[model samples]
Target: MPAKSVANAKGHSAGFMNFIREQGVVGLAVGLAIGTAAGDTVKQLVGAFIDPLVQLIVGSQAGLKAAEFTLKVGDREGVFAWGAFVSSLITLLAVAFVVYAIVHLMKLDKLDKSKDK
Candidate 1:
């Protein structure tokens, strides 16, 4: 009985694999490869361009310095690094804006095609 159950489980796993194969494995692989490359490109852009621009606007002190501020209340202490938080927030916003612009343009192109039809 245990052997039969194991065979059934193996058959189910094979069926799932076959289902994924039937769903255009080549296209999925190509899409994943392109996505990984695009991610790397964006990382470079953020590191080289966005980081510098943000540092300029937020001031060099905020960009290069990471100081811990301690808050004490009745012998309890909490430390915070405000500069690191600011830089991270700025980077997040810049990346989000770039993604939004790309998606918006793609949507506009789709709308334009529908209008033409």
Candidate 2:
């Protein structure tokens, strides 16, 4: 390879590394991984406990995760599965609560205030 081409390539690589560091990509990646795991854990928690209680109210044998209402319009039929939507909403709420608890417990929210000074 030409010397000039090699130098340019090296400079580009170094710039990319600097961008990653300055943008906090490593911390974002770690937070993403932890958030994914925490979401799954919260979903499981909801499925295990909350779903059954909701099922009793919805009265679906398949439970809240499978609840749906059927709709028909002039012989055309479709089911509006609000149950699944509700289930997803539950998952989102649970994940938010779990994340909030973790952030509160770890005092991670204080970091923002410190940075403001």
Candidate 3:
């Protein structure tokens, strides 16, 4: 019984390793790290470059220069930070474009390979 259990465990471990190998673990890890770094870089760019450009276009009061606005709700008043939302939207668009470009390139490469064969 003990020997059978040991063999089963070994088989399970081997299967798991085979699954990782088929999925290209090294490539997956490198891509994930690079993508995360790129996202952070984009966020910074939106905050630094896009924010100022937007502020210049919309004026100091309506744009990035004014980070928040006051809203009145009956007897209560609240502040809304719209600049952060603008920055976040810019970052999202940048990341989407990057991913789209990558996928487009990959599809082109695949087509080229099929043509060669």
**What are the clash counts of all predictions, listed in order?**
0, 0, 0
Tens-place lDDT per residue, model 2, 36-71, is 987787778767876666667667635666778988
Order of candidate numbers by TM-score, starting with the best: 2, 1, 3
How much is 106 displaced in model 3, in angstroms?
14
Against the true structure, whose lDDT is highest? Answer: 2
The Cα error of candidate 3 at residue 27, in Å, is 2.3
Residue-by-residue lDDT tens digits, candidate 1, 1-117: 699999999999999889888986876898799779877877787888887887677677454458568899998999888767767777788887766676686785353354245
TM-score of each: 0.63, 0.65, 0.56
Question: Which residue pairs in candidate 3 collide?
Answer: none
Instruction: Choose 2 or 3, whichever is better by lDDT.
Output: 2
Query: What is the TM-score (0 to 1) of candidate 3?
Result: 0.56
Model 1 clash count equals 0
**What does candidate 3's lDDT look like per residue over 41-81, in tens digits?**
76676667665665566566354535889999999999999
lDDT of each: 0.76, 0.79, 0.72
Q: Estimate the overall C-alpha local distance difference test score of candidate 3.
A: 0.72
The regions of model 3 sitting more than 4 angstroms off are 61-91, 94-117
lDDT of 1: 0.76
